[model samples]
Target: MPYSSLPPSAFWKLCRNDRDFLLSDIYQPKFSLTPGMRIATAGSCFAQNIGRYVRASELELVDTEPAPALMPAETAQRFGYGLFSARYGNIYTARQLRQLLEDAVGDRLHDCTLWQRDGRFYDGLRPNTEPEGLGSEDELRAHRLDHLRRVRAIFDTADVFVFTLGLTETWTDTDTGVVFPTAPGVIAGQFDPDRHAFLNLGMGETLEDLSAAITLIRELAPEIRILLTVSPVPLTATASGHHVLRATTYSKSVLRAVAEEVAALDPGIDYFPSYEIITGTPFGARNYKDNLRNVTTEGVQRVMSVFFGAHDGLAPVDRPDTGLARPSSDPDEEDAVVCEEAMLEALAPK
Candidate 1:
């Protein structure tokens, strides 16, 4: 009886058998977006794609810390200048995001360790952002201070905050419990079993970190709306000791569930199903490119099309021609998803 009263979308076959597969009915946005809204984006590597597409649309993607006028676009990107609202590179875990917010507001919850390689020192929290590492610890600290100031400005100005949940697995400093974006030794730091530890966050821990982060965000900007997404990209490698396939499935399942639970609890927060659009059976994994990891241009376009279409008066966002040069056909060169997790693959026994 209940089934009969529900809409056609409630039935799998009704939507699945349709010619276009009818994605329009899937996401009814909790709130409408206007072109004038200043949106701030931060999260994993996949979040970069969302930010790019948003910049292409009529909506404004807030860039608090932009590249210098003289720096080339490619060079700016390499030094982590133009990615994700601020240059906070690849925040791959909810805990890392929470710590960044705390540091920004002067909570000083965790004193980030400085990772060193050769004579250079890297910010343990964002090692990939400075590929060559800074010349000294003092210089790295100065850069971090300026970075946090810009991050605070974003919180003060943004209308909507978009975060993509990337992974449940993280590496943390044993002494301070500060989470790092990448595992130690993956990018710059030497792995020390006694000091650095791997953590796979459970459902409760993930929920708590995000909820706390939201509380801090609302404190800073009382009216800011939040949009959450789970990245469709699979894990590049797993330290969990399970087969990578099982590890990927587990990580994604936990993250997707966490996003759903968190979004349901708050009227101001919304979850977008970009993860389902790419990974669901309807696409049959065709959304992934030849390597079966990186999402293709067509895949990202489809996800963004549905997102912009959900807003009542706005036309679907067309993927803009950024005119950036494409890399060679090597699977590695396909897209500029600056994923530090991908570096783990190299450590696998050759």
Candidate 2:
């Protein structure tokens, strides 16, 4: 065999054997995260777990707009504190993330996207952002405006932004073609087929949306290094007619492809194979909890371990108190994963 046959990563232990691939070759990070680096996180619920791991590690993980100190801890969780830099919960699609940035930068508007539940207005885009729902239309507008402003600040200044791409499945407004975090009926409004439609974003559309997001980030924060990862957790349900398993495969496959393609577009952009680390059969699927949709404690630890190890000077992060790993244990600190899509399962007739 010629010396040119392989690259430097091939010699690493995890890559030395066929079954041991375990992401050693594909895991080389484009840049390193240091002790004081200002790391910000967004995207799906899994991205929330990433933020917790980073903070527990005693690193400088920045949360630009924290919840008010006087708020009850449980109130804070329901309102989406410590979930991400901003309170927008579970941006499950690339289009949602892109729109979030656009909204922050004042390039777009979706004020009418709010949903009414029994006459109470909930920012349908951030339905979980206010657990009790906002007091009035004026209050909702004020809160969302503040969130967008803080989102802009978070993106404009964070040293490294880590986003875990989640799902291709989405429900959108049929008439306006606007995307919502979940179908209006599931959480707040009445389910009207004439008003709502289902969309399973394909590879091309996902890539285009992601590319625009990266471009906007660069425009706002040129030096911001991007660390993209696909959430390993599978979809809870499929809006598409395909079997749930098949739908899960397709969603993850497209997200992984987009992460690779978009990461290649910028020198500072890097794709972390946390998806492969968990889903790779050789890993024995140890990363997922019994439900399989929720990631386990050990899984989060291993992913962050690989994340820090792949870099040059990052010290390992400590495991947070178990309370912070799952919402069931301690609602305030964990991956209070605002999984709105899961509500669709109840819609099925027994």
Candidate 3:
């Protein structure tokens, strides 16, 4: 049962926890991270944790989303949480991210235009921002060219690309073949069967798409290392119609398999089993929060415990200064109770 006695190939399986083992042995700051490194993250909500963790560790985390002027709590409440970063917008699957990259690269075959409606410009893919204006065809083309330039700039400056591969099924534009984070119906529009098709990418298809994405990233930043994780959060809904619960299982299974396959295929790519660390049977089943859905702090701690154990020498991060001070408990103060309650509730939770 000794860890050193295990064969090198069997180490990951026999380890008490892979995340901790990998962090301690392979991903320590001394070995895996260095000063002045720029890292970018995109994926599910769990992926946001990477940004949070890195920032907490006093490492540089690039924020690609436009920040609002309001305070963090106000911004989060108004935006439904995790503002100052693009969190809620579903990057549900790797294919969706791949398409975004393709669009950014101008390799997309479709003639797409950035349009303005309600005073903001929208990237037809995810309507995260308002359209600036509907310019002439030539003007719109120029804008897209500028947008792509900015994306390329970020890609070039990043030292690590942390992408969380979320879902395999996605909704694509019928005529243009552009992919959407959620199908038309789920968020705002009608689901036209004729125009949209569900993509349940098989192993080979997923590998090819991921490989292509890696190639594209290398073209932009040759030294970038990709860390891919399968989100452990269960799906809120499934298009497969095989009972929502069953759909969650099916989706996670496919994604986990694809992640393992892709990691095996490339040396520059690494797989982190954060999904298994939290949801695997080894942790037992009662670890979720009251909703019996979301993972609890204990669950998170278990994952981080493994992570820290693996990366043994990382100095503990100093407490974060979110720049928003703790609200006073004075009842007469406007919004004071809100902030106080928020702080209390966060700490009150087990």
Q: Looking at candidate 3, what is the lDDT of residue 308?
A: 40
TM-score-based ranking: 1, 2, 3
The better-scoring model by lDDT among 1 and 2 is: 1
List residue ranges in candidate 1 displaced over 4 A: 107-112
How many backbone clashes does every candidate have? 0, 0, 16
Off by over 4 Å in 2: 2-26, 70-73, 322-336
Which has the greatest lDDT?
A: 1
Query: Which candidate would rank higher by lDDT, 1 or 3?
Result: 1
For residues 1-350, could you state the per-residue lDDT of candidate 2 as single tens digits?
A: 77567775556553646565645456777886777788888888788778778777646677877879787655666678877887878898999988888888873457557667766888878787775687788877887888888888896669988888999999888776778888776777666788788899999999999989988888899999998999997887887999999999999999999999888877899999888778877677677766666777777777778887776687777776533333455322234455666666677779
| Per-candidate local distance difference test | 0.86, 0.79, 0.57
Clashing pairs in 2: none
RMSD, candidate 3, Å: 7.9
**TM-score of structure candidate 2:** 0.90
What is the lDDT, from 0 to 100, of the residue 137 in candidate 1? Answer: 80
The 10 consecutive residues of candidate 3 with the worst lDDT sum are 336-345
Q: How far is candidate 1 from the true structure (C-alpha RMSD, Å)?
A: 1.5
Provide C-alpha RMSD values for all models, in order: 1.5, 3.2, 7.9
TM-score of each model, paired residue for residue: 0.96, 0.90, 0.72
